[model samples]
Target chain A: MTYPKSINNLISNLKNLPGVGEKTAERMALAMIDFDKEKLGSFSDSITDVKDKIRHCLICNNLSEEDECIICKDKTRDSGILCIVDDVRSLMLFEKNNLFNGKYHILKGLISPSNGIDPEDIDIEALINRVEKEKIKELIIAVKPSLEGEATALYIAKRLEPKNITVSKIAHGVPMGADMEYLDAITLRTALFERKKIS
Target chain B: MTYPKSINNLISNLKNLPGVGEKTAERMALAMIDFDKEKLGSFSDSITDVKDKIRHCLICNNLSEEDECIICKDKTRDSGILCIVDDVRSLMLFEKNNLFNGKYHILKGLISPSNGIDPEDIDIEALINRVEKEKIKELIIAVKPSLEGEATALYIAKRLEPKNITVSKIAHGVPMGADMEYLDAITLRTALFERKKIS
Candidate 1:
């Protein structure tokens, strides 16, 4: 049956989200109809608020509400270390694990010639400026192990080579405690090639 | 890292949607931050419009903007045949297939004693009133085959028994073109028990 114009609009808008298809959008629209007016208003307001308030950090280009992101502003985080990631989501992942007590730089995207995205299209220039001006001694590249990710990492490493900065990429291998048999060919090859001399 | 207050709120609200977990919600929130200001505004407006405009049909309890839903308001559909579904999403599924040209009655929910949902909790009374007041000759029970779905269909069938209405439930068996070996035992049993005479 044809839904109301507003309902259809909501469903279409919801379809724009990642992983949401037509059926899932329709289900979400129907579920929203059951929400109370106050809850619906708050939910809608939250969407608008996110768009209005969230902005890129001046230093790292990471998502923030102020001029500088929390990571950049914090005194405890090591200013001598910087982690570069393809997007804010990856930066958040590292933060969630509490594995890196350093500042971050969000590239926003990788260099992909197929998609017409180049080094200039992302925040690469800002990253260079940050590394040149800041007291960062080591730069960690934490991008996905895709072709575009490799290209972006290599480009950044070459650019920072003249500045005498120690640049490194996160290791690629089978995940911790995962079955080696299920690992993909590339991951297995990388794991074997990068095998450490454990004493 | 702790997200901004607004971003965190948006992520929490997104998690309320079906199949969306913490990671999915975070990804959605991050993606939304990349949307242009105009697209973001339109998305937020659509949500508010859906909340303000969508309502239940006064006659069949289906979702609508006006007093009657599209199915109930359509003059070309057969008024004598009515399909009763547990929710609007199920009704939309039938409509999407373009197989049913009859009116629809949305029960909104199924009765589950364990969940403390009773007959009065849904739109059962409205279904009875519609059947009595309208020119309904046949009532198609299209609820799911779960315990709650069966109980709801049976209860509705018994309630309409005294009205001389031809109450029929949708067939329960193996899906079309599914292999017998892959089919579950309950489905195979139901398919065998409900086997039709070829004549």
Candidate 2:
């Protein structure tokens, strides 16, 4: 499976990307050869630029070029309500949909005992410190709904208990446009348990 | 859908790669942030290195760091039996599987009239020239089985009609480990058409 040094080098580097496998890396490396010099220069420069420029927001662990993320810097967004999420992607998802108009705290990862990840391994301490210092009125757990999500939300809630802040998690139920029969039992149960009454 | 400048730049650049959509590009860019400085540097340098170092092999249009590709330069391989392929990836596939020990002539693309691609758009001229000058005894058209593949192979064969070369195409049949019932109509028909007699 020997290839030319440069081709091999690029292929190997491409494989380090999250979803790219050996075959995909090889295909991508081959595709790059078709790119003109200008495109290649910018592509290469961006890879370096992304690393050199982007850093975690000082306050919320969100991706930012400056000390604080754009959301954190905005004066109008609610600072009293803090949305705790698993990572920046979750924050991005919320932001993209314009679903939440509040401050966010990125935990970086959730607690998964089976996977050896703990609350301490993530940014739980930072979340607690941020909530305390900022005097946030409400804490919303917006992590994914899974065992880890449940554990993380409960842990954060317990931590904020002494501070006497209102802690709540986003509801887990059947999603919009989901087929009822195809829904999982736990989700169905949650959907029924959290059913809203119409006036 | 506003993101930081560097993150947006990298995401847009990543989307240019074949088979990468916006979502996948975002995921890959986000994953790159977890990379250490050394990893990021090497990844960035290699992107530029692949473009700087690799060039088309002078002899067969294969990717190469030198004048000729490794296969074309090898003195031991059978240059008389040249394998004609659509691109370098196809050449690499054959090489990786140890299926061919002969030199490969990359056409770089297939002839697709509907897509406005013609015989002159590919490396057919170089192929014909190679066959005439090198006196290649046999040409194996190892391109994939499709309308474009058929057109490309036939076009090359027509060009070499005056050269008196024994040109043949690779056999198409049912793939190994494939379920007979799940096979598509064209593949099934191809399998039946190319079926061999029992010895």
Candidate 3:
């Protein structure tokens, strides 16, 4: 027999999330059916609250409740340095690790011509504007090293060249704890090209 | 920087679901933030509706929106035969494959002395009551082959012995498309013991 209408609707909605398949969504829906009314209500409220309150930071385009995100408003962070990431998720990864104390600019997406994503489609103009207005000494291109990511980084670097900002891409290499024998050729080549000297 | 309070709360709530970790919940939360208000509202409504409307079927203890589940209400299905499953998820799996045409009984959970789950913890009493009231000729115990499942099935079998109902456990053997070379000793032993003669 088919699931009830409400359960079916919830499963369909859950399938919209990344990596959630039909089986996963169905499992989630069935699990939710066991929740008490109060737990379910609070869960529903959280979903609605996120949609209603969360918005992109006006300055850096990262997720925020107000016009300015927490990173953009923090005075202690190095405002002179800005780390540009592909999206808020990537920005969060850096934040979770406490790896970067600088400000951030979320491009929201990359420049993928095949997927109809161009520079104009993302928040490139805002990155340029932020550099021009702020006293930024360095711009770290923390975008992934894919074709689209490289293209977006190059485009941004060229635009910010006239502004005299030190635009640099994050270093690429074999990840720590990775076996050398299992390393892909492309990664090995990139690692060789970007080799650093040891004392 | 940390996520805003609303976003953080949503991520934590999402993490409470089975199999969803911190990273997956964060991804889900971020993805939901991109959903339109109308979509988010409908999604939230679906979550609350499932909790409000869905209830265990009175007859079989399966998830349902009414007093009885769809299978229980369907007169075309064989009422004289009942296929008992461990939970609603297992019932759905059998239904999805169209493998069973009989009525069903959802045990909700298996008996596990170690986990403090006894026969009283699930719907065993309801099953006995239904068997006594209904014209059930064959009772198929389709629970898993784990220790708790076996004990629960054996207990059910013993309970129904005096009631003159034919209680049978689903066969335990090597699954279809499985290579016998990789089969474990216990599975291979069971497969050999339960061998059937070719017609």
RMSD of each: 2.7, 2.7, 2.4
TM-score of chain A of 1: 0.92
Candidate 3: residue A43 lDDT (0-100): 93
True contacts kept of each: 0.77, 0.72, 0.83
Q: What is the lDDT of candidate 2?
A: 0.88
Q: List, residue by residue over A1-199, the lDDT tens digit for candidate 3.
A: 8998989999999898889999999988878877788889899999888878888888988888999988888999989999999888888889999999999988879999999998889968877877878978899999988999999999998888887789999999999999999999999999999888998
List each model's interface RMSD: 1.2, 1.5, 1.3
lDDT of 1 by residue, B1-199 (tens): 7788999999888888888999899888888987898888888999899888888888888888888788888999999999988877788889888979999887868999999999999858878888888969999999878999999998998998888889999999999988878998889999999999999
Best by DockQ: 3
Candidate 1 global CA lDDT score: 0.88
Better candidate number, 1 or 3, judged by lDDT: 3
Say which prediction, candidate 1 or candidate 3, comes out ahead on DockQ: 3
**lDDT score at residue B135, model 1, on the 0-100 scale:** 60
TM-score of each: 0.88, 0.89, 0.90
Off by over 4 Å in 3: A112-117, A196-199, B113-117
Can you write out model 2's per-residue Cα lDDT over A1-199, one digit (the tens) per residue? 3789988899999999998999899889888889998899999999899888989889998888999889899999999999988878888899899999999988879999999998889969988988889899999999989999999999998888888799999988889999888998999988899999998
Q: Write the per-residue lDDT of candidate 2 for residues B161-190, one digit (tens) a residue.
A: 887789999988899999889999999998
